[model samples]
Target: MLDRSSARDEVVRLTRDLVRIRSINPPGDELPAAELLAQRLKGFGFETEVVEVAKNRANVVAVLRGRGDGPALMFNGHLDVVPPGDLSTWSRDPFAGDVADGKIYGRGSSDMKGGVASMSVAGGLLAASGEKMKGDLIITAVSGEESDSIGTRHYVERNTLDGIGGIVIPESTSLELVIAEKGTIWLEVNTYGKTAHSTQLEIGINAIEHMVATLHEIKSKWESIGYAKDPYLSPPTINIATIVGGVKTNSIPDRCTATIDLRPVPSQEHPKIIRAMQEAVDGMKGKLKGFRGEIKVINERLPFATDPSSDFVKMAQALGPSTLGLPLDPPFGVNFFTDAAIFATKRSIPTIILGPGEYDLRRNIYLGHQPNEYVKIENLEKATRFYYELSRSFLK
Candidate 1:
């Protein structure tokens, strides 16, 4: 029999402890947290490995082995959190791991050291029970999910997923099941020109002006391209994420750069989009004088979806309601992408995103990457139990 109370306490403690560690992503320092998790899993008799992918950036892989016959299940969560933007906006210290009003308040409490702690505790409890499962339980605490998925990409390159049957990403899904997610394409466009005195406007080509024209042409061309609507996800979209131009106000700008974020449905081809962008640049070059522009793909990940009727998805739907005491509503999709976009899509494994924290922006429950982020203690405990039950049933 599983000790639910003990498991809940362990999860709460672990969540608080993990939140206290500063694993902010810009610096991508996850080594301390990775070491802590490795120590915890080793204490539970798990075979654990901590690999440093970069300086102060690391990934932890822990496995509880079972009989060799059954399929393995992998649980993944990131150790890094987005930086707490403005401290004054927060009611408490973001790294204090403060607990009040039934919530654990911290930068990553919801998005999502809470989920990480729950999954770690669930795996620990499973190992403690000595249940003799036929399959292995693997837990990965990775870094760099906030910026680029460097740690996961490194893991994928280093390991093979031949025997791993399924994956679970404990992202903040509010304990709801997510069958699909959008893909990401980050493209950087640069426009170059000759610098001259601002008074001598005729002598210099303004790169900023060229960039404006390029952006307009690109948007028009991209919008003209049609795509079939996806039932699970919203229409594909694009946004100008960042812009950098001009060194000073006195001189004509010599160069300008902008990064575009494109979210695509699973049916859209990444290469085709790249081609379209290049075409837009070519069109601009013909229309504008000295419109020297280049396009570079910074990073990309495919949209991921698991068939609703897949056996693994069906199993999750069947077990979720009973385990979490919430009705398993019709499957839905998330707008944001996850590490699943790489791990699950690359391995062709059935996967689901289900975990604690509220992600519904319509309800104003944006606990992720916002001021005063927190995870309800109750939700943390419930998530731990659900992961435990789901892992046990799947392994059986």
Candidate 2:
């Protein structure tokens, strides 16, 4: 049987090892990382496999079967992290997985690999100890969470949550239990206009100018309407992510496009949200001279919430952190969206997001998708203990 101390050390080492792998997601290649995790899980006596959902993208699934009759439990974490841009801005190598100042520094350290390692170590400990739990304990190291959540979505489509009791998504939650997340809508808006030489300014229809008007209309009329305020989550927000226009300084652009990100609370519906944004873009049709524009949904994911009074949530709260031995604060809400929505909404599995690291306004830490990202070593150990205890409570 592995002792607590050994488990903690193993968690740290495993996290560091995972952080060393460059599993960045724009292209979303997680095969190498998934293979590494699969090997370790197999060594720990867990039934492990790497399933490829897309070319070069894989998810690692490991299960430690229990001896008694009880519902299965699943632990989920993503394998891919956002790309580490501008290496010069970082204090250390983004892929070095260096440990210093009581933290493990790397690209995926805080955003997730730390939590993934903790869950793996926890499952490994259970296997090593040969504990007679009541149900199966499953760990899924998924890909594409940083982008499309295709990995978890693919897994959900293939697997059933019929016997599974609950799911825990170890995203960066600062140890607080997250019961709800916002919905997401990505939009691409395009404006068409006639191109002409700069000298013939009156003859040319400027697409960029039309796009600016569209943006103003969207910000003023579209965002303010639709969607009610959620008591716990934030109000629906809109962000213009990217814009492209004009081919050359001398030519009036014929076409312009902009990408926008819309985050709405649980009360909002995707269809209504899209319609609202589309209305704003279409409003520019006759208002702006020589302007015709259209908006299309690029991507979307629904908001998710689980009843906090569920047996699983209560049990998780009671288990708390193994390190502190103190009661944690009441469950809270997270504004960010996650793949947990897939399991909770699609599979109808009760799910909660619990993990280490805090990157909110209170912390002023930009660990996720930022340079010099890191997760505290102590937090890793604590998270390992928490996952182990939670798994035991649910599965055993």
Task: Candidate 2: list runs displaced more than 4 Å.
Answer: 199-202, 224-226, 321-326, 358-364
Q: What TM-score does structure 2 among the candidates reach?
A: 0.92
Q: What is the C-alpha RMSD of each candidate to the true structure, in Å?
A: 1.8, 2.2
10 residues in a row with least lDDT, candidate 1: 358-367
Off by over 4 Å in 1: 361-364
Clash count for candidate 1 is 0
User: What lDDT tens digits, residue by residue, belong to model 2 across residues 244-279?
Assistant: 999999999999999988888887777776777778
Candidate 1 whole-model C-alpha lDDT, 0 to 1: 0.88
Poorest 10 consecutive residues of model 2 by lDDT?
357-366
